[model samples]
Target: MCMAHKSCVSEADSAAAAAALFAWGANSYGQLGLGHKEDVLLPQRLSNFCEPGCIKSVTGGGGHSAAVTGRKAKPSSLLVAKNQGKTCALYITSIGSGNVDVILQRGSPWTAGVLIIISNIRRSSLLPPFMCLVCCILLLYDCPDGGSLFVCGLNKDGQLGLGHTEDVLCFTICKPLLGCPIRQVACGWDFTIMLTVSGSVFQWGTGLASSGRRLCAGQTLPLFLTAKEPSRVMGLEDSTAVCVVAGSDHSASLTDTGELYVWGRNKHGQLASLAAFLLLPQRIDARCFQDEKVTAVWSGWTHLVAQTETGKVFTWGRADYGQLGRRLESPEGQKPHKQDSQLTFWRPQSSVSLPLCCLTGAAKISCGSEHNLAVISDKCFSWGWNEHGMCGDGTESNVWTPSPVQALQSPSRILLVGCGAGHSLALCQLPALSEPCQDVKVIYTLQADTGNPESQNGMNKERNRKERQSVTSTQSNSDRTRNEGP
Candidate 1:
């Protein structure tokens, strides 16, 4: 996801640099040395995995799944596992004590929320792995239906669910979770939470979470703050979560039953309260949307946004630059509010109050460091800071009202859109499916306001927005009907 430069190594190349053909592993981290994170990697292309008779063996280890691909004309062995689903992943695989192949099973018409995690590679887990000394730590949760929610990075306090205190290098499959079938995973600084389809909750890590202890002394509520492994929450057995999102130090979970559960820091009212922080996952009420069920919820570094079935958007938390919608100013003075620069709130502010809230069925929203963007069908709408035009509203001015990007408004249908700390990008495809060679690619622009050479480049960044690139596809032969692997 680096934009400093444009270089990508294919998965095979990402392995040990196969064929040195500018493949994935060939330029791992794009010279940034961003080290390992998750999953198994072997020297093979995604095409080889799908090609008949192209794979010879597939190995499932303690926390990883790998395959040895064999090509017909020039067969070679390469351990492999192709991502079959579109979901977020936080993994780093190594061949150590873990040898559990991550599996996901579903029961009846209830689809499995297979949000799988393959390791607890805590803080020091990135020390580099040896060929024979690699280990894996993996966990699974149903995504969409009960999946996604991957947790990785530092866990020095046993916040990771590997059941041990040692930091992990590669993703080590958490063997204990194989039988539990997880629905989602949410991570706080040194803690993690897991949700199950049956409405069960399990948490791990230091702080009040490591012990799964509830502080009842000065507290009048149930606390599931600290634990070293996945522990079930006492009262959440009847709750079912449909969506989950995390901020830097706080977390939020929305249940199908029209309830919101929050925990962790709330210094700025990000958790909908005045309390400094919460050690337990407490159900916080949103007074503004009291009667409507939240359809989606998103968390920024210190802000929160929610949408209702009526296409209503509610925002709160740090609104320094109007991150909480167009509520930056007061009606009397028509200027930025008194708390606009310093105070933060957790209460939901109406989006309709803003001049651009009528999005005509706005369906989704994405947040950035201090900006926000939304999508309705093929068009995208943005608001907030325009210091570097992160709003993509065709100007470098701060905009509190949502407006569609004119540059990306036609000839093609939007396929995907993303927002980053300093830049924003969109993917589009020609609607002419009848044209076999239609191109689909990303359009990028600089949205960061860092006043440097790159910042100067931001002024001339318009040229890069029109750049188009196409990905290659694989063709199957008649003999490719049968494929085999270990």
Candidate 2:
């Protein structure tokens, strides 16, 4: 999400940009937020977020989904005051925060405001009066003003962070994170990882597996753990992490200084270490990265993807599904190994490089259990497992190489991309039209299965006008319904 500048667009205009939510694929546990537990073959709109700029960030896990949504505070001229010898403008703005509970059982979304605090501002006389700006400006914030975590779906392992092991039928707030602002959240098979703005890491649900585990070679140990409540993770005392990633059974973090730390299951060398499992965070060997500072890291069920400041990408771990995005050459420089084979323990799994031809110049990357998505400029490319049409290429065959998602190759700018166990999500900000109107057309594209994707739907000038009217009418009825309770 990008910040809005007043010079280019007003705050109210940004807030009213109509950034909608679209989801597809597996909904067995209603993880797609589509109001029912039916598998969608193509992208479908999740009706609740159609209102302008309501959704902040969205993510999904094995059988669940979560999103952070809220309104942003606008800079306003609180008053003009005198300071020292000159008259200085005293400005103040209340940072707005809220959350919406999507009760999948009922399927209607409702908004609930959270913590509202005063944000720091420099005194200025040029500040304008109070008014709502554009939806894009506020909804795109990395950390909304006091974000609230709303989660729903299978929580039998207490992965929802609601202080209980029972499954959540509605989107409920994580009790421990009530007033605290969250920076990021990552969901694993039966656990969840959270990163706060202060860089504190939290984990909940079942911990790393305990069977046949050892800290080092020949050291027998048995350890099992579970946290129904969110617990702060240790071992990252020396550095602050800027991002966090969670695979099916492993977790990772990238520090502000560019160091990479990984923990948990190493069944397929996902930890980049020889240890079978890591109970605490351990920095990956810099030598394996060619001494380059890692810029970003993403994970799948048993593989890891990383990008360096030099624009180089490296992948390791389970490659039988082509999730590595490139071939692994044999030690003898023989022919590239087959994708269905596993990496030998002797091979330097940490140093495997993603071929430049496979992927280059990607602005962002996301990984599902066995697939990947990359957005470069205006196009989104997908590869690996597509059994559920998660690759969005209108097919169920596994994609061994990067292929463009024709539906998303449009003038609309891609804002964010996310993946789940067998589904994919892409949030796009549609271009503004030349004519003036109260609302802008925002389309949500959820990639679930294979068929002609709805994104291919053609729109002429008159059709677009009618769709805009329909959106307006829907919003109007929504507003009236809110005012006139049934």
Candidate 3:
């Protein structure tokens, strides 16, 4: 997914010059689009880009990468957020024109406009070495001439929405959505969700309610689906959704009026409860927010993070990985057990306790498989799994509370931070180079400070100049003596 995934864009027009792309990190499945599968510690530039346009968005998930290209003014599709399935394969879904945009410079990889990659896995064992999964749900809002949706990757279930059971090597348009102009899309463990411009929501793919023996009466698998087509979700028939986000097994959406609805799996309180899974969209009780209007919400594999119009953050669900930003420590070295009554909260609760110390200034936040990151007044802060140094903190220690990524402080005033499975991504600004240039100027001035005797170089140069001037005057005087006084 995004851990194995990286993406970039060029502000310049490709017709005048080629768009550049840069990628680094785990590339075992060719998620980096480097022509071969290999892990790179340094950011490498990629050449496989669509000509004549600029990159709108890029997404990587489950070891696969997808990019969207469009005009600068167009409402572009969502890039991949990085999510993996049991197959352990790469799924690349480009939701724009057949052409794509991925740019990278030769020496500069962490440039401006770089989005964080998000990748994750089902409860499986065939994963890479990175701990903590970052949910890389493919959010492709592809709108071509016909504005059809396309998806490809491992399709054990019809998660690709191609109306077929086979895995596709290339993007295959969903025949069922020929004329529907989709505006937003998000993916979960094996399902895809999107909100059309007409304010309709649709979904396709497998859910646990259908995969089990007791088919939940009306739902079944090859479960919770009838065919590999984008079917309208009747549960949201009357709701006008603005955007949607898919967790590993659940989904969350916000309405134009700041209303939030959630559905699908809720095993670890992913849907706001530990009791059972949500089969359809259900409006969460207003009491969860003390009646505050919610502006946005996001779901991780087992935890949920939400934001209110007032700029406060609330979290609930799993607290095992310190993802909840709270201390769920067990005795000594013992690992925390899920469903531990004391550790697990069955309701939407406040953040890891307020006055969040280092992260008190968090403006926006996102959830990874087991970590969190946020943008705070131009700085990036993080907590949870730092096993892969994903926190950018220059250490591998797990942070139970919010902390600043000291390594990204000085030259990097981060604009955004993306948390992926066992890795983290960020978009930081390139501050003005005038500072370094000014430093050089200062050095030059010091060398010319002959007024100070301590300035050895300056003093020597002054002495040499005087000696030359004195010798010139003596030579002139001697010439006059020979021509006139003689």
For TM-score, the strongest prediction is: 3
Local distance difference test, each candidate: 0.45, 0.57, 0.52
> Each model's TM-score?
0.56, 0.59, 0.62
- Model 2 stretches with alpha carbons more than 4 Å out: 1-49, 52-55, 61-182, 204-206, 212-232, 330-345, 348-358, 430-486
Off by over 4 Å in 1: 1-152, 207-223, 330-356, 384-401, 419-425, 433-486
Per-candidate clashes, comma-separated: 78, 15, 21
TM-score of 2: 0.59
Which should have the higher lDDT, number 2 or number 3? 2
Better of 1 and 2 by lDDT: 2
Candidate 2 local lDDT, 366-473, one digit each (tens): 887778888877567787776666676545556666766654556656666767666677776655444344334333233454343332342122235556877999
Error of 2 at 12 (Å): 16
Which candidate wins on lDDT? Answer: 2
Instruction: Evaluate residue 116 in candidate 3 and report its C-alpha lDDT on the 0 to 100 scale.
Output: 25
Native-vs-model 3 lDDT?
Answer: 0.52
Candidate order by decreasing lDDT: 2, 3, 1
